[model samples]
Target: MKVGLLFDARNPDGWRRPWARHYARILELCEESDLRGADGVWFTEHHLFADGYLPQPLTLAAAAAARTRRVRVGTAILQPALRLPAQLAEEAALVDLISGGRLELGLGAGYRLPEYALFGADLNRRFRQTEANIREVRRLWSDGGITPGPIQDPVPLWGGFYGPRGARLAGQLGIGLLHISRPMFEHYRQGLAEGGHAPQTARVGDLLPIILADDPEAAWPRVAPYLAHQMNSYRQAAVEGTDVPPPPLIRSDELRNRDPDGPWGMLDILTPEDAAKRIIEITQGLPVTQLIFWASVAGMPDDLVVRNIELVSEALPPLLQAAHPAHPAHGREREAGPPLAAEGGGRG
Candidate 1:
């Protein structure tokens, strides 16, 4: 029941700050999360997003690594198709070393057509590219001529998935899986077993949007705009053939007494008590290794996001773990394959 915080720094037009300041604030928030009982801090990548999404996650990851001491630093999903495998490997290794072996590499085949076009990459080949990139990156770290590879013997690698294809690919590669829902989590585990690997050989983490407050009714006004913006943005992308599916529309009339089990990808808005109760219920029959709370989203104000993080951190983990103990992901420490054992020295 490790709890991490994800920063989806979407600076929409009306709720925007200067680009430089916006990033600085995100990093500051990451630092705060580290001090306030978070196990990890993660960043996400996107390109050509209308709301000025953070396109360069690795750079921000390095900055976060430098600023934080205890919390692990990670990329929720770094699009492998956008960069050369060797380059991506180098950057990831450096960040791992810089963070004192605290980096979890999360890779993805990006969905947006515009991003692929802008990067001169073929969207149709992205799935293949993602698989290729992971192989090449591992090879470079293990056998390439680079001096000093990652500090972690084989850095923990996780794949982000939009569907079963990605889940199956993750299983085939023997990497961890990042899924948005419980059904996807099951798919990933089944895929792993189908690949002839033990289900416990890989881990699964869930990325969820959560809003925690003493009075959720009073808090909805402040959170709805950001939540709505996030949902609508994904809806638009889905319409354009992005792999992301549109979430059920978030409506004001549907705010109160919302069923926790109603939809697969809707936001979770609850008081601390309800959050603990709902989370316990959600993980009752699930083996979710990590619960990565998406506290900062679509230009929500810093204070509110920080408060939400605190509330979630305080409320969820112990309760859920108490309800469902002995998650296998917490016990597994096997690396997918042996490192190439390259000869290089780097500070980690």
Candidate 2:
């Protein structure tokens, strides 16, 4: 059960200041804490939101790679339709080189009508565009010859699928799948088998919101509103045919009525222990090879975020160690990545 941290870096207060400083600190923490327990770090791409979310992911991945030593870095998702396939391939290769081949490329079709409208892309053709983009990217990276080609061939690509077609495409293309929840795992497994890739051991990651608190009661008050905000945002977005499900705010009742094929209901209430236990169950039942948690959402303060990381680190070891008893506990915590340096000096 490999763990990774996902950062949206949503500046909900609006971009009153440059994000470079904040991002530097974030990367520094990622390197340090990732060494402590996390297996990887991930970031997302969005354009022109009131929250000042990052629009570029490969750039961010490169920055993160430079800061960290052992932890793998990747985009939680790259909106493929926004990029030319060849350009995306080139950037991916460069980042992979920068990270010494420690890149897990997660590609997705563009969502958000605002972004598509801004980019002049037809939203209806998203799946088609993604398919084309994926095909072209593979060709450029694996088959196309450059005058000066990349140091490595065929970087690992994970297809981010929200539905059945995308899952089938991933298996057909022999790429890993990135799903949002556990039920989607069944779809991937079925898709892989149907695609003539039976018994596949391909990688899959589940994305979820996570926080670890000293006390659930104390943490709940602080974290709940932020979690609710996230849920509301998703609910609003889902109405636009985005497939962003509402968070599971009312657990017991929601759990009883849970749609096996739908996204997870709001998870803002689960304690760290319950969250970890749920995660283990989901991973064990699903074909998930990696688990990525959205660690810094709702504008969480840096100190609280670090404490959350520590909590997760503490909680995960015994579980993972017990699960893999044959392996020795090589949990030697490493120092966090270097502090965000000046423009030229820092990993970014």
Candidate 3:
């Protein structure tokens, strides 16, 4: 299995840093992940959050691409409704080029109504717009008239689907799937089969929020604040009907007071051994090609986040070996990518 890092960069009150430093820290951590043999570095997109969540993920992807030599840089879920198709295509293509084609484009029909209104897009028609934008992007890439297209023949597309319709759309387009639900994954595979595509060709990534430390007893308290913030933020979105089948609230009181049995299906704070075992089980028998870890969640402190990255890196090789024995050992390690500019590139 390919191991990667995902940064949402959500800066909650009392834990926030300067925006420039936050971005810089993310890249610095990306460099650390690459050095420690991570396969990719993924960024999430949000807008107008109280904590100043990342709003421009493709731009962030470009920044990540510039800083590291090997780690694949990607946007976890860039809303297609927010940009003109051609303009989005141009920006993505440039990032892919700068990264030497190491870009995984994950597109989403954005959930937040406020975000849709802010961008002057119709929330109800966002999915349709997403579909149309993707088609236009494909056409642009195929057209010979367009200069400086993405270096990857088709630039790997990973559709972020939360429901059956989106699953079918992903299948019809033959792109990879991200943050997949089990039902959606089945639907997507079925759709692919109906479309005359090989089922094994489907790439699925599982997003798991994890933190590692020597003493779980000691670490959970430190990481719990950010975890609570992360969960509560999602809960609020779900309550607002942005995400359906609402996520369980990881209560702040429980975390702050170190309540045992805090929450399941959310943050998995474990020791290296436990984490490795759980990852193996969580990913086993699934189409999970990539295991994306949300390490620096809710803007956790730089030191704690770095330690989490180090622990995961140390455990990943063995975890990959046990979970995906068919592949060569080197598959667990990071692969070298494009040349890095002296000044590095894309930090907006």
lDDT by residue (tens digit), candidate 2, 1-348 = 567778777656522335777777677767765666677788888776656677888888888888877777888788888878888888888878888888888888856787787788878898889878888887776676332345556676788887777877777677788885555556666766766775556667767655666676665655555555555555455445355554444322232344668755554434556766776666665556667776666565555566666655455645655665654223355344333223232210
Candidate with the larger lDDT of 2 and 3:
3
Clashes of each: 1, 7, 0
Winner on TM-score between 2 and 3 is 3
Report, for every candidate in turn, its global Cα lDDT versus the true structure.
0.76, 0.67, 0.76
Q: After superposition, how far is residue 325 of candidate 1 from its true place, in Å?
A: 5.3
- Model 2 regions lying over 4 Å from their true place: 14-18, 145-153, 180-183, 193-198, 237-263, 269-272, 324-348
lDDT of 3 by residue, 1-348 (tens): 676788887877776666787677678778878877777888878887778788889888888888888778888889988888889889999899999989988898978877888889898898899999998898898894366899999888988887898888888788888864677788888878877888878878867766777787877766777778877886676446354466677765575444456533667677877887876775556677777777676876566676677766656656567656786324544443342222222221
TM-score of each: 0.85, 0.81, 0.87
lDDT by residue for model 1 over 1-348, one digit each (tens)? 677888868889867777887787778777767766667888898877789777888898999999998778989989998999878988998999999999999999988888888889999999999999899998888885465689997899999986988988888888888874566776777778777888768677768656776777776777777777777777676556455665667664454455667664557677767776766766665555677878676877655676677765555555665565665222323222221121122101
Clashes of 2: 7
Question: Which residue segments of model 1 deviate by more than 4 Å?
Answer: 180-186, 194-196, 240-262, 325-348
